[model samples]
Target: MEKCRASSRIVIIGAGVSGIAAATRLLQNNFHNVQILEAENRIGGRINTVYFGDNVIDLGAQWCHGKQQNCVYDMVKDMGILHETGDYYSPIKRVRSNKEVIPHELATKIHDIAVKSMPSGPHPVVGSFGTHLAQAYWRRIESELPELDRTVASESLNTFAKHESSIIGADNLFEVSVREHIEYHECDGDKLLHWGTKGYRRFLRLLMHVSEDSPEELGLLEGRVQLAKKVTKIELACPRKVILRCEDGDYFEADHVICTVSLGVLQEQHEKLFTPPLPAAKVNAIRGLTLGTVNKLYLEYGKQPLPDGWVGFFCLWLEQDLTELRKTEHSWVEGITGVHMITCQPRMLMAWVNGPHGRHMENLSDEKVLEGLQWLFRKFLTFEIPPPQRFVRSKWFSNPNFRGSWSHRPTKADERKTGPWDLESPVLGEDGHLGLLFAGEASSRNYFSTVHGALEAGYREADRLIGHYTSCSAKA
Candidate 1:
């Protein structure tokens, strides 16, 4: 029985966190015949860390998010590599598009009021989170502030909404399901835990059980992954084996196949990727869940350093200014709600954009993007900021491998009664055995759109196969 388990061929699609975690767990359980097929030339699907300026900066997954109940945090808590970040909202200056500085106290008050009015937990009523937030926010704004401050507060709330949209990977809160938003379980503890210069790729090393100081690879995973293997089809009609055909004219047969591709890729390729097509329920689940875009623009300042004690800029644009900008090509700059200094990289500033604007930014030329950034800075900042020495940006939306950033539960998801559970269901072969399995962050019920969620999902699928083999061994 042990020999049979060890000899069973297993193939995992994508070399992302979920795929890596699945392979790691399988190897630990004596499943030696495992291979990870990655479409890209490199590993770490969405956890991309690159060297920028003087130190390392994360282009993909940046923070650990929380410490409690977070597997990534628990694994590295004792390593002395993680640090708690300061309050993300406070100690920052708020500047309007007209170059007027909002009083710190007033900004804090508006932020507090807005946050307090948001739904804290799931409600019996079903609706869009955006609708609930806007209605509740306006009521508090009307009762708390004078007419003079009302206009600025309302504009500031728009900036806040943009920030929320980026966080949830949605174009706007109105598209997100209110029930799912409240149902998301946030791990209790520090909300933003920084990895410093080490970067999020450190978590991948931990999964492989590799030491940071060593230049060695784990024996189980060494040569186990095949890069640039874009799998185009999964033939599951075979009664005894599952066949995978890659775009490079290569093929592999496996007793079991686990797919860890992103929800975006699944949405784009699922129709033609599977043989005999996926189950109708699974297809419905894929259509119901949405993959949103959240992109980052990094500006490197080599000669001119940022102002002292500088944290970030929270931008507030008046209705008239926004209306005027919409006429110009730089209108996409309005999508940028804020820009902040990278905690570890002192010479770098990160700007965030999401939804339609994020996708638009991807299509523009580098010169155009830089010019837009200059225009944005000139309007909001009091100081004379020069163009960056170098600029780097993420193009997740334009990347063929990843159609968007991550997954989010949209309002349609509730109406359709479909979600991660349906997507994660295994497909049975003609022999009445599990042939195809799924694992990814989108498959996580409570931890969707997080690195920890991806890790957990991978472990879940690996454990499923392990349990099945264990049951068979016991029967023997």
Candidate 2:
């Protein structure tokens, strides 16, 4: 039985966390004939980390999110690699585009009230989170805040909306389903766990069972992953086998195939990639689920602009300023919700942008982006800031392999009546064997858009295959 399981060939598409997790679990279960085909030249898909200036910066997935019940946290919690990032709202500055500095105490109070106003559980009524939040927030503001502070509080809420949009990977909260937003299960413990200088790539090493102190190496996946193998076609109609044809003209046959491509890729390539076409339900789910863009701009300064112990700047734009900016070339600047100082790198700052504005930012030249940032800083801050010595920006929306950042449950998801379950279901071959399976963060119902969710999805598929073979062998 063990030998039979070892001989069963398996091919996994994408070398992201999900794919790597699936491969690792399979190899551990004695499935020796496993291969991972990554379209990019690198192993980690969206978990890219690069050295900038004096320290490493993650261009992709940065934090561990939560500790309790998080598989990624469980693996590295005691390794001394995880760093607890205290309250994200503390030691911060909130300034309006009109050059009005909000008091820290008042800003914190408004922020707390705004957060409390948001729905914490699934609403019995079906509606958009934006609508519900707006109504609730304004109601609280009318009763709780003084009339003089209401305008600033309203602007602050707008800033909070942008930040929430970036986190949910939505252009606006109105596009997100209120019920689905609340359905997402957040793991208990610290919500922001940083890897410090190690970067997210360290998670990959630990998955391969490689020690941090040892020489950097891909322990189990040394020769198993083929980079730059973009699979353009998948022939699943074959009697008892599954065949994958790559753009490089290389092909492979496997007893079973696990696809861990991002939701964005699936939405773009599902029709051309599959042989007999994906089920209508799966296709509908793909269309219904939204993949929104979240981009980052990294700026390295010759001199630090912010004081020590300062978290970052939250840009609250007055309605008049925002309206005027929307009429000019600097409209994309509105997408930038906040500019945060890198945790360990004192001279570096990171700006976050989301939605259509993120896509627009990708099309602009670096010089233009810098100009916009300079204009934004000047409008909001009282101090004069120097130009960045070096600049780096992420273009996840423009990348063909990844059309956008992450998935979200859209407002129309309920109407479509299709979801992650439809995507996760396997297609059976003529011989009644599982020929094609799906695994990715998007397929995780409760934990979509999370790295740990991706890992869990991978383990789920691998266990399914293991259980299938085990049952079959018992009957034999």
Candidate 3:
């Protein structure tokens, strides 16, 4: 604590979870001169909750992924925020073109088989996930399960792949990295919890600032945040200091700057964003790592009864040929993968949009989206459903601030041994002074694409600065 410098001016770019966490941690460590610059008017860069009809919907990040090792889960649980566990074990109905509900047990069995068949070993990232998946499936079909119907097995594989791709937020499995996918950090349990839009927003508020009425309120990180300050350029050519210029023509100077912008944004603006171009190593890492979109469409229907115990409406495109669907570029709705029926809020249905399809979905009007969904449900389900009273779409891909939802596994083209560590390395001045540090989910090696990963990244960078100042203060 003696190494703490209250006068050190630290500026954080982007008010996402990583940025917010970094700011809060700095303030906690007695770093008083800190400022947070946010591109959007509101906080929670990717963790957004929107309201529609009578219910609150999480348009952005929805789940804790795991309970035990997850930092986000621990904090929310301690706060006593209301959330329900996702029923992955719950029966997924495979709807036939003739409207037959395939037995739940059969569907679960297929799911289990698919999970067991995930390709293991050192797979090069050169080819897409789809290619690896096809090879893996063929091997499994021929060697392991020769007795199973080929068509049924293929459909099951497609369903599972589509779901997994949505989870990765990739445009297609082909865009995913097989190596990175294999290396991802897996948490303790399969348990997932969703904090309704309002609950999540409250959680964000708690993370960013202290409450006035609460005795524990520190209030150091709250008012320092400046919203809607889109940082266009970061000039770090100077040895001792760096300057950040915003889109709104405002300028801020700081001894150390922590950038928490999304990987998508960095991909789009890396060359122009930095005054001195980034190192080829950093550029290659950025190009090698991919950012994927996972948008959600919320619909409110008048109290409809879904399956008895099922929490989700899984749509298996049985009518469409999997090969043909994969080949076609115009088949955007094919990516309108599944709908999550909220058990807590009965009337709401959240449809998932992944990758390039998410951008395509954003182009269509609300009526068109509704029409497509209606047609899809009518073709699969036995029940004749009424039109949704209202609908909201999350256009994360198109949002300039976000560009995409989250980071995905790196492709083979990225030769760097460490996936995101290359990006996480600090940019230094001529004098070897730390001018900039990167903190975000994309920059995290073990926790990429998770909120906890982002939070940890924020803390990591804050600590880096603290350690530096501590050593300097001691020497002085």
Candidate 4:
């Protein structure tokens, strides 16, 4: 390891996983002077852990996603959290159709073939996933899964494809779409899926490990992180450094600042915050690209325990044509979607809506949606669902800090324009000499949305900055 270097004061904005990870790296690299300037009072920006009585529900990210290359899983491997087993490719026992339940292992085989058809090298950067992979995969899904209702598999594939396009089905999969765009940029070709039966949202579980210790104690929990403080503006003309101003009237400054806030936040409030202003290209990217949002509608009910071999899904068609079903937008997906009922121990049924459909749900009152869910229960289960003793939803888009889930899938034209985003030079001098640096999931070319992606970006930027410093010092 390199010996301790100059104590250059660095200010890191945003306290989410990426921000924290960057701080952790600076300190670990023996960079003595590092301070994080978060706009909010809480450290975990989007990574929120809420307790509804006894449930440790995650409002932000929970999944380890692509467990094979997950930084989160590596961090928690030694933490000793009970039931934290890795079971991504769990069997698909129930289909939203009117046929016998397909065997879990066999269903996964069919799913694998579908994934194989996906375009290699960065998702979303290509054509609409709904048109390509979803349609193509659905075709294969039906032919492969024999004895399965042809229409049921088709619908499932379609819905799955929409997820690739929609905010919900993507990364941060259970809820937000921030990670989905990230995953598209990072992964080699395929991504893993964790069922989360033991605990779906693993990202929060990992963050719970970080603030567990203080610096002196050498444990991650001791670090104090405040929640709820929102930043209003930021100025980089602090003579010798950068200063951050929040609506709370608190001010902070340091040598170099890492503005790790979400692109969504930039899209919403940057114009009001930055004095000198970001370049047109930067501003346009923030505004031109839409801030996608989606919410997971969780419903709880008393177990009615359906008959044996009932095989789920009252629909004989929707589930069968899964491929085409994903294209079904807004109101259409609301009706024919999801395995809302099953005899799991937790007894919580969830349906995720994305794109315009998600916005519709977000706009409606909880009571109205709850009423609609009641009707759904009666329509599908032939019984009324228990008015959930508890209810929860993630409002990432509505939150001030996170304007929307995260960046959308990169586009084809973006490649030539934003070509080699990796080589675009870190936050540096006006002459590109290297005074400032940028690091975050958005900055990620390979590992965009995942924790690993952000971590890798931090490491890459750190290396770039360190190299420049080393070269200058050596020349002297």
Candidate 4 per-residue lDDT, tens place, 1-476, comes to 22224666666667776776766666666666766666675566666655542355555554455544556556655655423323322322434433444566655675676677564544444444445565666566657656666665665455455545443233222222222333454433224332233333344334434243332321342343334545666565634455667677877655566666776776677789775676555654554444466566655545433344432332223433434545543243453344433222355555555555555666667776676555544544543357776566666666677766645444432433442253224444344333345666666655554556566666666565466557756876
Using Cα atoms with residue i matched to residue i, what is each candidate's TM-score against the true structure? 0.97, 0.97, 0.90, 0.73
lDDT of 3 by residue, 1-476 (tens): 22247988899998888998899988888899999999999888898877666657677776777776787777767665646665643555676545666578777766766776665556554656777787777776777667777767776677778888888777677667777677677676544676654545665667756562465422556478899899999988655788999998999888889999999999999999997888787887788788888888888877754656656566666645434555754366677666667545678777787877778988888777788788767766777767888788888888988889989775544445447888899988777778899999999887899888899899999999989888888787
lDDT of 3 at 265: 93
Candidate 1 TM-score, C-alpha based: 0.97
lDDT of 2: 0.88
Look at candidate 4 and tell me the lDDT of residue 173.
24
Candidate 4: misplaced stretches above 4 Å?
Answer: 1-7, 78-116, 121-126, 134-154, 166-229, 238-240, 284-291, 301-337, 340-345, 382-384, 412-416, 419-425, 429-436, 462-476
Candidate 2 matches the true fold with a TM-score of 0.97
Winner on lDDT (1 vs 3): 1
Query: All models: lDDT?
Result: 0.88, 0.88, 0.77, 0.52
How far out, in Å, is residue 36 in model 2? 0.4
Residue-wise C-alpha lDDT for candidate 2, range 14-91, written one tens digit per residue: 999999999999999989999999999988888898899678888889998888789899987777989998887555
Q: For candidate 3, give the lDDT of residue 342.
A: 59
Q: How accurate is candidate 1 locally (lDDT)?
A: 0.88
* Backbone clashes counted, model 1: 0
> What is the per-residue lDDT of model 1 for residues 1-476, given as tens digits with 9 covering 90 to 100?
22367889999999999999999999999898999999999889999988887877788898887988898888888989988986876777788988887888888988888887777674735888888888888998888865637678778888888888888999999999887788788998787898887888777887888888778754358889999999999989666578999999999999899999999999999999998699998999899999999999999987435588668888999889899999999989988988887787777888998899899999999999999999989888888888898999999988888899989899999999988898889988887778899999999998899999999999999999999889878888
